[model samples]
Target: MRDFFEVRDVHVMRSGAHGPLPVLGGVDLRVGRGELVCVVGPSGCGKSTLLGVVAGLLRPARGRVLLAGRDVTGTPAHTAYMPQQDLLFAWHTVLDGVALGLRVQRVGRREARARARDVLAEFGLEAFADARPDELSGGMRQRAALARTVLQGRDVVLLDEPFGALDALTRLDAQRWLAATWRAHRWTGLLVTHDVGEAVTLGDRVLRLSGRPAVVAQEVAVDEPRPRTPGVPDERVVRTVLAGLGVVPDERAPDEREPDERAPGLPVRLP
Candidate 1:
């Protein structure tokens, strides 16, 4: 209904053993209430850096992050962050791990556990509530991670390659689950993904980032319907990104030549 997350001319510069480097350069972006936006880019692009800035893990040298008309730059707990790894403790049971967020937020013990159980059930992880993180499959662990985030009940979610570690089939399955979950909950989500298919499948709008000093190269709407079909979504958007990256020739014009099968480290790994 309103602008839930906004990044205006955001910039992140880092200085370590290496010289000063700009990871994000005047990046301008917005995620409206209940909107799902996906970010895709090359390997060295700063998609994750942008997420870190939004999550308040990294401070921007310039610009700001706004949540619900309030500035959250360098502030914690304004939004929930889900990193590439699930980060579930191996020793903790599924419910326990999920409840950790609520507990940290000082939600009452009884109330937090109840809400955690309910959220897990909603995600179809109720059966494994008592199981340890190691006992669950990859998808289930990610589900638990999401459950934890939802329990915090934050308005904006910064998802950093949440499904990167799963197998192809598992990743697809998780994508569907994530799409369904997003539809059901309708939280404003910003996801950073290297996989173009993942971006197309889950995003209402997709943004592509160029190399270092990452800037938005292109933003494409995913016109496909939600609850995406396996290959269909990939086919629709992957070709577009491939063309943008010059891996595939533009089909808009008549060209007898096919896409270069040998674009180094392209998303689909063409045969």
Candidate 2:
């Protein structure tokens, strides 16, 4: 199949207190249908900024963003963006909140609500459909947000640290759920996360960006299968990188160090 998303020679800049700053520098990326690509980099690198550019929320000063071969630069509606926060409204029930996106697009009230309910059910949130956000746990709220994004019916989804705040168990659960959900729906997804484990667990290919004026530094492929198991060799790669970046420790057998942990996403600060 042809690539569902393509970005070429992309460059992005922002004007800050110091003046014009280069965010993304000549970055090239492509994602086939159902591909999940993770971007890892140092803090303050343009990881989130690159996501915004791909989502068409921010136009690159130079380059092109093509969705299924058509340029979508400066077009925001072609993609669904899920930020760090679920952004769930405490006053609205899960059904009502998830339906907001569809309603905004003028899908009739009954139709939108139905679509929302169905999507929420797929994520195992059917029982909580009438529950308010405050009643849901952090992970459930995030799941509700995912359902809302899916209901928006966008071909691409940009996830910005959607599982960052969850505890380890919840994070693992969410990751498994995401892989299953992505497989079933086959939406092209680009996820921005600070967690190396999350990136390796969900991404088909992981892209690393250098800090601001962020250029694609390196690309790592996570060739493992879905339902990633702990203590697996692939999972070790995640810990290796974490240790190398000083986030964790280089506690593995000494010979295991150099090649395995070399990818990227080292914590900005060493332990």
Candidate 3:
């Protein structure tokens, strides 16, 4: 596949009380047009930091971030980001907050809200449109924030654990919604998640990062059909990601993992 986004040898450092701490060490990855790539790594392994770099929230100490062949390193203009938290304003109504992205884009308020309402209706948040963030449930808040992120009209959307805050059941619902929306819109996404299942369910390919001072350790193609059955799609793929994170499944787990079989679609590179 042709590359739509590229992070080449990107490195980052964060200032700590003692000194500068190296976070990402020569990280590199690429995504094709309209593809969703999910990143998984241990907690505090710079997974989010990597997304921040691509989102233009942090300028890499070295290397560059390119989108559609243009260097957008350290620039937030071309991308839309939805962080871990919903980040909806307490004062702004759902309609207002969802329209924020368009507003910043210079779309007229009336027109922005009209567009926002259309998306809210589509996302099943129309009933809560005029309600404040605090009034909505966790899932609703996430949907609202997602609406804002996507309304920006950027081809790429950076998601940092977008469903992390919700409870298990709610998270599953959000995952389904996100998958369907992605299929419909065909937008490019780079999502970071601690949940391997989430990564497996949502990504066309799952990328695993090494420990701190992170880099791409491995990439597994999720060859399963779309809208996968979230948590139980494929144990072997889950095993592969877990292995990268140094995790081993229970010896007596119901399905005894085969010793030599690789995941069904051995290697997948979008074309």
Candidate 4:
């Protein structure tokens, strides 16, 4: 089957204080229709920058972005992006916040709000529909933001550390919630996260990126079926991914050390 979304030989450079700095160097990726792919990399390894390029928020110096066989380079209309923070409008009610996308599409206020309410109900946020951003918990806020993203009905969703800010328990809840939601709608998703366990649990495949001008170092297929529980990914898969990223000692190492005892959410140093 033809790929649903693709980033072909993408190269992105940014102007730093001193000079030009390369963020992505000849990066290539593809996500099939109804597939969920998670990208895990060291902190400041240009994961978010890569997502921005794909979302058309930033243009790559070279290479093309294709969505469902159509080239959409530098076109933000083709995808919906949800950043690390929920960025909810503090003044607007939860319902209105979720309805923002539809309203932007020239949907009537009444109709947009009705659609938002239905989706919010599906997300189990109906009771908080009238609540303001401040009134909802951190998890609820993220859920509301996701509702807005889904309401846009875009073919691809770019999530940049969407659950990074939540507490352990809350993040787990959000992960499971997102996985179930994705299974229901099956919109192609590319999520950039630092949590290895999260990637293993939520993604159909996890891509590990490393180095200064990062490229895909390895792609580990989850193989497990979804509706997966958060924080409970297959230990073997997690170990394989960590080893590929050099987060854990490689089995081939002559003097292999015990697996790192650090918690799952801690940042993995780039080699």
Candidate 5:
């Protein structure tokens, strides 16, 4: 695959309770043009940190970020990044919030809101265009945030648990919507998700990272078609990701296997 967006040997260190803490250790990632790739790893791993570096929000200690083969380290304008939170300003109207990116691009506020209102309709938020974020539902807020990111017209998009804050049902709904939206936009995406199913459903490939200053441990190709329904992750691909994260279900019958093995949401460890 052509490396449209690449992170090479990235190393990140953040101030922690105990001096500088290593977050990413020699992480390398490559995504083809317009490919949606999912990244999964142990909790507290450098997943979010990796996205920060790739988005140019945080400069890596030792590595380079490339977009279409152009080095763009410490340049935040190259990509549109939607972090874990919806992060909609409560004071700004839905239209204004969605228009923030365009305004940042030097588009006049009047023209930006005009464009934002049009996009809000696409997200089914036209009726609430004048409403504040507090007046909108969680799903609606997320949609507005996404519309804003997409309006930036960046070729690369980074999503950090975009649906993690939503409830299960809402998350499922958001996932479905995002999949369809992504299919339509076809922007190159790098999403950090803990749900193996979400990764399989949305990603063309899944990368598993090991913890303690994370590093890529395995890469699992997802051969499924796009616009896949959310909540129904492919067993084949999910198992591959989980197994890569060192999670294995006991084949023995329930009577013989350990209870934890039979339980749902088994804790997967990274070695």
Candidate 6:
């Protein structure tokens, strides 16, 4: 059966000052319907680039991006992308911000605001409806941004470190909220994050990318139940993903190391 989402041997390059710089090297990935897939890689390994390609914001040098078995390369209609930054417009109220997508879709301002209010209440941000982006806490801002994304009603949501900027406690809160929200509305998701525990806790499967011009180094399936408690990822899953990323040293004896076995390449270390 065809996957709900597919990235087939995708390759991307950008023109650098010196010349062409390769970012993604023959990348292939897929996410089944309603599956949340987390991607971890060293910084500058083109994680965001991959999401951009999937989001149809960037055209791949080679390969195809398909949603629901139809090619959607360079067409963003199939996906909703939320970047690392909240990117909320300060002038827009929380309600207006969340309603932006609907408004863009030609929803009447009154109707958009009404729908936005409904989602805001669902997101527990109704009280902050009139708040500016600067007035809300980091977590609240992200929630507002997410509410906006969710309002797009897209089946695929691409998240690039959505909670990376929050404080540890706030991050945890955001994770719990996100997990619960995702569970209730099971959109196929691809999250790009450096947090191993986050990946383990939130993703149905975690894919690790390594080396410059990265490729998938490993894929770890997380068997834990959803709406997972924040901060405490399944220990075994965490260890497996951490080990794959070289965040944790292997316990093998020195003599057992094969000459052909290469060390894991990590772009960034996770806490």
Please give the CA lDDT of all the candidate structures: 0.81, 0.81, 0.85, 0.87, 0.84, 0.86
lDDT of 6: 0.86
Q: Write the per-residue lDDT of candidate 3 for residues 32-145, one digit (tens) a residue.
A: 999999999888989888888888889999999998899999988888999999988899999999999999999999999999999999889999988999999899899889
The C-alpha stretches of model 3 lying farther than 4 A from their native spots are 249-271
TM-score of candidate 1 versus the correct structure, residues matched by position: 0.89
Q: After superposition, how far is residue 129 of candidate 6 from its true place, in Å?
A: 0.9
Which lDDT tens digits does candidate 5 get at residues 1-271?
7678888888899898979998888888889998999999999998988998988889989999988889999998889999988889888999999999998899999999998988888788899998999998888889889999888889789999998889999988888878878888889999999989988989998888888678777777788776587888888778656755668753446785334345534432222
Query: How good is model 6 by TM-score?
Result: 0.91
Q: How far off is residue 154 in model 5, in Å? A: 1.1
Residue 238 miss distance in model 6 (angstroms): 1.6
TM-score of each: 0.89, 0.86, 0.90, 0.91, 0.89, 0.91
Candidate 5: regions farther than 4 A off = 16-19, 250-271
- Model 2: weakest 10-residue lDDT segment is 262-271
- Candidate 2, position 195, lDDT: 80
Top-lDDT candidate index = 4
Clashing residue pair totals per candidate (backbone < 3 A): 0, 0, 1, 0, 0, 1
TM-score between candidate 3 and the true structure? 0.90
Flag clash pairs in model 4. none
List model 6 lDDT by residue over 1-271, tens digit each.
Answer: 2369888888898899999998888887888998899999788899999999999999999999988888888999888899999989989999999999888889999999999999999999999999899999999999999999988898799999999999999999999888888988988899999999999989998888876687776777798876688899998878766766678875656565433223444232211
Consecutive 10-residue window with the lowest summed lDDT within model 4: 261-270
lDDT assessment of candidate 3? 0.85
How well does candidate 3 score on lDDT at residue 178?
92
RMSD (CA, Å), each prediction: 5.7, 5.0, 4.5, 5.4, 5.8, 4.1
